[model samples]
Every structure is written in C-alpha cells, then in structure tokens.
Target: MTALPDLVLFAKYPVPGYAKTRLVPALGAAGAADLHRRLAERTVGILLQAGAPVEVRFAGAEEAAFRQWLGDGVRLIAQVEGGLTERLIDAARDHPHIFFGADTPDLDVGVVASARAELQNHDIVIGPAEDGGYYLIGMRQARPELLTDMPWSTDAVLRETLRRCDALGLGVALLPTLADCDRPEDLARWPQLEAPGRCA
Candidate 1:
C-alpha cells in the first residue's frame, strides 16, 4: 500500500516590497503584502477543513513569524535557499508529496481529497490554473527534468509541463481548472468570499 502523500503548502513571508510584488502597482507594497497574507490564511483554513495536516515550506520569514501569522495547527519550515525551481527540485526529493500554493485559497476540500486518491495511482496529479500554471501538483518521485529550465509564471506553464510529462511517459491525472489572484484587475474574478469555492 502506498503511503499518503505529505501535504506541503508553499508560501511567502508577505513582507512589504517582496511579497506579491506583481500587484504592487495597484495595491501598494503594504497592501499587496497584506493581500498575500490573507490569501495564505484562507488556504490554511481550507486545509484544516479537509482534515489534512498543514505543513508550510515558506520563504521570507522565520517559522515563529509564520506561526503568529498562520495561527496554530500548522507546521512551518524554511524553504531551501535558492530560486523557485531549485526549491521545487529539493522539495520533490521527498516522494509522494502534494504541493499546494497559498495563492489558491479558494480551493474546496473535495479537490484535496481527490488529489490524494489520484496520487496513489498516477505518477503526478495536477490541479490546473486558469493562468496556465497549476494551483496544485502531486508527484510520486523526484523528476528534476520537470522542474528545471521551464517557463514558470507564464501562460505556457501548464502546457509545457504536460508536454514534458508526455515526453517522459509519466502518468498524469488532472483536476478541475481554477484561477489564481495574480493581478489587480483579476481580483474581480475572485469568487465570492466563501469556504466553498475550489482553491484556485
């Protein structure tokens, strides 16, 4: 029997000027950071609701600060030093890990439940994002080829990732498509505040 994948949530420290910088033009440094913090909290709540262990591998702040920000019941760890891709490869070292991002807080518990089950049968499970990236990804082993030298934060992210998976003949399971709050204008696309929406 395969072990349940570890639930690893990736997030930032939400420090002004560093977190959510892309939205700074509209929300200011502080405001964008605040939004970033709130988004993470929302995702935390969703994980709690799903009855899944909350382990956050984060950047920008210490575990103590994250404890205060995210509240209790979450295990926080510092992300390995380096760029996103590097950190991803390191995280992938642990087999059977389901990686979730804080940006997609609107995720419903059902999606998480499904991802867990799919990981048992597939080499990877992807929760596609409207922006062409993925909100969630689960993998059974470290496949550095899928993590390195890829166009991250681009509309081709999902497409390119799938292409690589195909080239490697990896079994992939896809979940529902969702949106991520990346830009100021896209804030309107945020579903009504509800614990019921799919975590995008």
Candidate 2:
C-alpha cells in the first residue's frame, strides 16, 4: 500500500473562555467550549476514518485528554509556544504535510486526500474558507517567510497567502472553499447544531 501523507489537525483544549472565544457572546463561554470540543472530535473522527497518517497538535490541553478523546492510533503533539504562524511553520518543516483547523465542520477526508495528491504536482495546496481565511494548508517544505507577519483572521489571509506563494515561486493548488463556524451567524451553516441538545 502507498504510504499516507502527513496530516496535522490543529486544535485547542475546550476550556471555557479560551476555546472558540469568537462565539462566546452568542453561545456563552461554556457553550462555545462545548462546540469547540464537538467540532474537534468530529474532525478527528473523519480523519481517523480516512486512514491517513494523522497527528493532533494541540494547545491548552493535556496529552492524556487528547489521547482519550481521539482514542488510540492517533499521535498527539503539544503545540509550541508562539503565534499561530510560528506553530504552523514548525509543523510543516522537513516534510510534506496537510495542516488543518478544527473549525471547519464541512471539511471531509476526501478533500484531505486530494490535497496529498495535489502535493505531488504542486509545492502547496490550500483549501480556502468562507471567512476569508483558509481551512487547510499543505506544503512540500516549510516556508516560514510565506506566513510571517500575515494579516491573520482577516479577509486578506487568502489573498496574502497567494501573493506570498507567487513571491516565493511556489506553485499552489486551490481546493474547494468551505465554511468555518466562528461567529454566531456562521452557526446557520451547520444545521445539525440547530437541533435541540446537539452540540449543547
């Protein structure tokens, strides 16, 4: 069987007032944290079922909690102290990797597989998110400069990343855009959350 590509799922411990803070006003701190936990669990489940080489790089949580949450067969790594860009750059070094956020509930394993395949022909692959950021980013090698001093969490993220790719002479493959639940309005995208007691 062909070796699976490296897949890194970025996450944070579902601590109230820390995780998913953007939605705290609408969902309350505890509610938002619950949502974060469910989303991370769901995304991890999808990747695990895909049977790819998967690892979870997490912040604010103990390794034991993650092991128990994700179950066996998945590697867990603690995120280093730094901004998001630094952490991501560190994870991408020395190998081709698909790094994804836990917020994208609509993202599936097939998209991840496609990214791995795309890396064979391109130096980078990015799945754009509806929020103007990206849901996933994959690269054949670490290019920290591409992500340095970026306008993170802004509408410029995707555009800036593409510009950086051009400047670095890296060929990029674009995947279908998806939605990430961040604000209260964005919750409408996930109909399952509308049901009573779901993601409560």
Clashing pairs in 1: 104-200, 106-198, 106-199, 107-198, 107-199, 108-199
Instruction: Give the per-residue lDDT digits (tens) of candidate 1, residues 1-200.
Output: 76767778889998999998987887788877877877887788777776656688989887888888888888877899888798887777566888888776458889999998998999999999988999998898878888899899889989999999999999999999988888877766664422223334
For candidate 1, the 10 contiguous residues with the lowest summed lDDT are 191-200
* CA deviation > 4 Å runs, candidate 2: 1-3, 194-200
lDDT of 2: 0.85
lDDT against the true structure, each candidate: 0.82, 0.85
- Candidates in order, TM-scores: namely 0.89, 0.93
**Model 2 TM-score on a 0 to 1 scale:** 0.93
RMSD of each: 3.3, 1.9
- Model 1 alpha-carbon drift over 4 Å, by segment: 191-200
Candidate 2 per-residue lDDT over residues 1-200, each given as its tens digit: 33466889999999999999989887888888888888888788878877778899988879998887778877899998999888887787667778888998887878877888888789899999987889988888787877789999999999999998998899999999999898989987786763435642
